[model samples]
Each structure stands twice: as C-alpha cells, then as structure tokens.
Target: MTTAFSLAPLFRSSVGFDRFNDLFESAARNDSASGYPPYNVEKLAEDKYRIVIAVAGFQEQELDLQVEKGVLTVAGGKRDNGAQNQEKDNVTYLHQGIAERAFKLSFRLADHIEVRNAGLANGLLTIDLLRQIPEEAKAKRIPINGQQVLEREGS
Candidate 1:
C-alpha cells in the first residue's frame, strides 16, 4: 500500500514552486516500476555533476538522449534484429542475469544547469552536467553615492 502526500499546505506557503509539485506527483505515480539498470550520481566539483547508468546490453546505436523544458531523458533499447531474434530462439538460459529491456529515465534540471556531454564506455553511460550562472543572475555589489549638505539656508 502506498500513502498519498498532499502538497496543498506547502503550495500555500511557498512561491515559484509550481514545477516542483509536478515533479513530486510524477515520481509518486511512477514508483511502481522496477529499478532496473541501476545508476549512480556523483558530484565531481562544486558546480559539476555526473550521472552514470549501467547499460550492459545496450549499444551506442540503441541509446538516445534528449533535453527539453529543463528535463533530461535517457532511453536505451532497440527492436530485435535478425541476429538477436535467432539467438533468443536457439539459446536456452538456465539463469538470466543481465537485463536487456527497454528503459527510459528522466531527470529534472534546475535553472542554469545544463548537460555538458555524454559518453558510453564499459557498459556505463555517463552524463556530465554543468551549472553556469549568468553575469546578471550573479550577485553584485552596489555603490552608494555620497553627497555633502550645506547649512547656509539655516543661517
């Protein structure tokens, strides 16, 4: 059984968090899916991050990456080719270990965070991220102007 959480109170008190609510709802809805092809998220630097996912049976040609509306999506899998179909038909497995199913994973990005690069090696898919704050968005010091007052009018 799953418990439902209401964000009504949080919405009443918070501002500019409309998207967060949607993310929460989507996560809750998709919680039933199995966590196949495990992944790891690592922080390489203060403003840099990397996500590595295990995709042992997937090839570069079978993988896809997309970014849209502050969301990054990674998908892996392809329709069975002739060789794969023949292998499946002829081979009998005593135990199946590796997962060769299609999967799609999505990640929400914060403002100014962008995908820098992606690479696949040794059955691991690595996605790099960088946070670039614009000059106008960064904090700046304001200079205060000083003026001298004259007392001649009072005299």
Candidate 2:
C-alpha cells in the first residue's frame, strides 16, 4: 500500500523550498523497471557521504556520472563496439543469469552538495560527495550595537 503525505506543514515555515518539495514528489512517483545494480549510501562524516554501486560487468569507460541542477546521475552500460558485437553474435547462453543491461540512477542533492570523486574497482563504483558550505553562506552571529537602558515614566 502506498501512502500519500501532505507537505503543507513543511512549507509553512520554509522559504524557497518548492524545489525540495518537487524532489520529494518526483522520488515517490518514480518506479524503475529494474533495480539492476544494487547500491549503498553511507555517511562517512557529518558532511561527507559515499555511494557504492555494484557494477559487476561494467567497465570504467562504460560508466558515466554527472551532476545537473542539484541532481546527481550515475549511469552504466556496455558500449557497442564492432569487436564486442561480433563476439556477442557467436555466443549463445543456455541460461542467461548475468545482466548486461544499461541502468541510470539519480539522486536529488540538497544545496551545496558536491561530488568530490568517483572510482571504479573490483566491480564496484564508488562516488564520494561533500557538502561544502561557502564562507558567506555559513552562519554568523551579528553583534548588537549600543545597549541603552530605558526607564518608564510610571516606573
């Protein structure tokens, strides 16, 4: 059973969160045909994160990673080549268990989230991410100026 949630309360006190709400809604609505490559998202530090995807048969050249409009996309597939096509035509699998299909995964990132690095090793693709808050965007305390005592006439 799917449950629907109202984000009205979240918007009441928030400003410029329309995109945030849209992200939530889009995530809920999307149902991918296949969960081809399993993945894990782990937090290494307060602002650091890692996403590891199991891409058993995909090579580094076949994988693609991109960040566009606050969304991170990871895609992997076997690229079509003349030699590979000829080799595949000669092979016939009695029981095909391994999946060589293309897949794309997208992650909606909050503001300031930046992809630091990505590496593929041992059939795994690992992506490192960091949330970098700019100097001006960081919180700062303002000093209150000129403290004056006011005396009420009645007092």
Candidate 3:
C-alpha cells in the first residue's frame, strides 16, 4: 500500500480564517476582472471616498448599479453603435487602445459603507463612496480617573 497524502492540513488552516476566509475565498472566484470598466478608488476628503469608472461606450440607460447584501455591483451592456462606428477611422497607427467591449465589475463593500452618488461625465463614470459611521465605531474617548473602582464578581 502507498503512503497517504495529507489534505487535512488544508482544511485546518481554512478553519482558522472563519468569516474572513470565506470572504477572501469567495472573492478569488470572481476577482479575475478587477480592472474592468477602468475604475479608481480614492479618498476625496477626510471622511469621503470616490469610485470613478471610465465607460466610454456605455450609456446611462444601459448601465445598472445595485447594492445587495453589502456588495456594489455595476454592470453594463454595449449601447447600440451610437454613431461611433460611423466615425471609426482605422487610419494612422499612433495608438489605438480603448476597447469597444461590454463588461461588468463588482466591488465588495464593508458594513456602513454606501454608494453616495454616481454620474457619467464625458467618457468617465464616477461612483462616490461614503462610509456612514456607526455609533459604536465612531471616535469616542473614555474618561479615566486614577482611582480604584469597585469590581463585582459573577453572581
């Protein structure tokens, strides 16, 4: 009989990850296209964030943005030509890089984080991110006095 290989180690490590691992593992399955729709995540102000996506070929009517169970999903299908093909000039090869493709991009959101605003301007689609500070997570200092407080044992 041949020696047995250990798949046990893999399961043991995974158990330690718990919820964190679940989120991590789920992301890997569909994270092959993080750069799709060409977006940017930035902290606009002290407590504000912004996500901007470049959607040159997608129209406002053709795009969909939804928030479900703490996930922000942005999906779009190509609009009908929109006179772009009529102006398609396959001439001098300076650099032709912009893709005329239809794609969908998703972002995993944390608790209290919300999509504040979204707009498409010029050829760029901007999605603003705002985090609603929860009462427990917000900054609050505890007053401490240098004195021995009474302690109660479990009843």
State which candidate has the highest TM-score.
Answer: 1
In candidate 2, residue 99 scores what lDDT? 88
Model 3, residue 41: what's the lDDT?
64
Query: On residues 56-122, what C-alpha lDDT tens digit does candidate 1 reach at each position?
Result: 9788999999989887888888667898788888988999899788988776677788899999999
- RMSD values for the candidates in order, in angstroms, are 7.1, 7.0, 8.9
Q: lDDT of model 3 at residue 122?
A: 92
User: Per-model C-alpha lDDT, please?
Assistant: 0.75, 0.76, 0.67
Whole-structure CA lDDT of model 3: 0.67
Model 2 CA lDDT for position 57: 83
* Best of the candidates, lDDT: 2
Model 2 residue 38 CA deviation (Å) reads 1.0
lDDT of 2 by residue, 11-112 (tens): 322112247666456656654642567777777888888888899888889999998987788888888899988998999999987787889877767788
Report the CA-based lDDT of candidate 1 relative to the real structure: 0.75
Each candidate's TM vs. the true structure? 0.74, 0.73, 0.64
Worst 10 residues of 2 by lDDT: 8-17
Q: Per-residue lDDT of 1-155 in model 3, one digit per residue for the tens? A: 89987543222212112356655556445455555666666667756777778888677987889988877788888656646655564356577686657677766676677788899899888888777778988889978999867677883
